[model samples]
Structure formats: structure tokens, C-alpha cells
Target: MNSKKRAWFVLGITIIINILCQEYFFTEQFINFNPGRHNILYSAPYFVIGGLLYLYRKEIHNWMNIIGGWMLLFCLVLNIGYFLLPISDLLGHSLFPLLIVFTAYHMYALGSDKKWLHNKIIDFLSGISMEIYLCHMVMFRVVERLHLENYISDSNLNYVVTSVLTICLAICFAYCVQRGLDKLLLKKIA
Candidate 1:
């Protein structure tokens, strides 16, 4: 398969997964844990972009300083506004991911050299992020089952612990599932 086509396929699958998860899972779940208006889940797109950029570092690194600086600025502004003003949590968290996805899509889709995107790590993570997105809820349910929230009463501290555990668990589960999938598929071909 061609690199351009493959990238599109990954992007498409990501979009599809987002749509399904939102329609079925998030729509229901959002009501329960309505983090206000910041939409932290939007950050998922950046994780995708960050994974891709890590893989295509040669091409992306050139812009890392410039892009990184602007991203930082944007985040700082959002944080100040989030805390100082009566900004909604959903909007605060939503902004970063929207910025990231826009920046990444522009940087790679229109401007990047197609030849540089065949990096193995990016391709691998891009393919598996969908699964991570899908299974993340299971991990969240586990955390709740353990009553970990009972340990952290301060809202800020609770957010911090939950965020850390969510990311770590998602990565671990995704790695295990992807590795198993690769082995299963490779064995069939071999």
C-alpha cells in the first residue's frame, strides 16, 4: 500500500472510531462526568499527532521549536483564562486538542513530505490508537470499581491521579493488544 493512502486510512479509521465512541459511549458517559466545557477527550487527537510526529521526527523536528512554542503559548493563555475567568472546563480542555489536530493536519497532510511518513513507530501507533480509544472506558470502569477516587478528595488531586492512571493503563492495554494482534497476523502470513 502507498504511504499517502495508508495515512489516509489511519486518519479515516480514527475519525470513524471517534464518531462511534461519541455516539454510543461518550454521549452517555459525558452526562455522568461532565467535566464542564473543556472537552479533555479532544486531547486524544494530539496524542495521535504526537505519536506521528515522534515517528516522523526528521521532518517534524524542524518545526518542533516553532510549533512547540506556539502550542505552549496557546496552552498558557487557555490556562490563565480557565482559572482567572469563569471559563468552562470543556472549552479549556477542548481548545488544545483542536489546535493540535489542526496544526498536525496542516503540518503533515498538506506540507509534509510523503516519503518521510513511513517511519515504523508512527505507523504502528497510528494504527492502534483506535483500539486504545475504544478500550479506555474499560480501564476507567476499573478505576471506579477500585474506588480509587475515594482516596483523592481534593478535586485537583483527583483529576491528576485519574488522568495519570487513564493514560498509563490505556498505553499498557494498547501495547498488549497490538503485540498480540501483530503476532497473530504475522503467524498466519508466515
Candidate 2:
């Protein structure tokens, strides 16, 4: 089979697996067995979807240009329906795979043409996103340990302040780690 055919096959299998995992396998026993949602079975489909998106990005971009507006409207309707309608948790959860894929596709297509999305802060954050993900939990723990919540009397304001401070600390830490890695790699190469 050709590469395109293989990709489609993999995508189909992953989507089925994702649906099955989300619908049936996400029980308390499964959660206990796979603590922190760290199981590859739970995340592999998303990684596959992301890979496929990148692989056919150009083709998808052209298709998006042709149907982007209609797609956006459809996604908006889905979002409104999902939020406003009194749907059962199981029904809503079942639709998650489709909803997430459509939302991600539309976001990519719509955001591609927006100049505001290319700002310096966005660029910097994107560069260090992986690092930020890696260290964010540690930063949150540090914030909690420091008892920063006591400084603000209002619970809501305290939550917001601590969240923002934690994110800022995480960003700084990620930036430092990235820079240090870059320097270390440069030194080894030189």
C-alpha cells in the first residue's frame, strides 16, 4: 500500500481505538490502573491525529480555504448545542473525539491567516511549550508550598493571582531550561 493509504488506515484504527477507550475503558478500575492518564492507549490517538494533520497540512489548508466559513459555522453550532442542550454526560463524552478534531482543524485553518497570532509572546511560548508542560506541576507545587494564597484574602482573587503567578514562574523556568540546553548542546557540538 502507498503511504497515503497507510496513513488513512492508521488514522481510522486510532480513531476507533480512541472512541472505544473513551467510551468503555475509562472506568474507575482503568483510571486506577492508568494513573494520571499516562497510558499510551489514551493519548496515542491524539498524537496520531496531530501527526496526520501536520503530514497533510498543505492539502488540508487548501480544502479549508474552500469550506472554511461553513466549517466554522458548523463548529459553532456544535459548540452551542453541546453547551446549551441538556445532553447526558455519556452522550457528550462520546462526541468528544469528533468535537475535538473539528475544533482543532477549524482553529488551525482560521488562525493561520490571523497576523495577531504571530506575536512575540506567542512565539516564545510556543517554543517553550513542551518545557512549560514538563515543569508546570512543579511550579504549581512550589506556589502552594510558598503559601501565596494567604496573601490575598479573597478566594477568587487568590486563585487567579496564584494561577497567573504559577504560569509566569513556569514560563521563566521553561525559558531558562531551554536556554541552558541550547548552550550545553552548542558547547558539545563546538
Best by lDDT: 2
If scored against the real structure, what TM-score would every candidate get? 0.47, 0.61
Clashes of 1: 9
How would you encode candidate 2's per-residue C-alpha lDDT over 8-71 as one tens digit per residue? 7887787677668766686675665642234566566665666566667787777766764676
lDDT string for model 1 (1-190, tens) is 1254565466556555554555666665556664422344444454455455455566655664446556445556655654676535655433444544455454543334345556786677667778788778777777657776678788888878877787779878998988998999999999
Candidate 2 local distance difference test against the native:
0.71
Off by over 4 Å in 1: 1-68, 88-128
The local lDDT score (0 to 100) that residue 149 gets in candidate 1 is 63
For candidate 1, the lDDT comes to 0.60
Task: Report the error of model 1 at residue 38, Å.
Answer: 14
Candidate 1, RMSD to the unseen true structure: 8.8
RMSD in angstroms, all models?
Answer: 8.8, 5.2
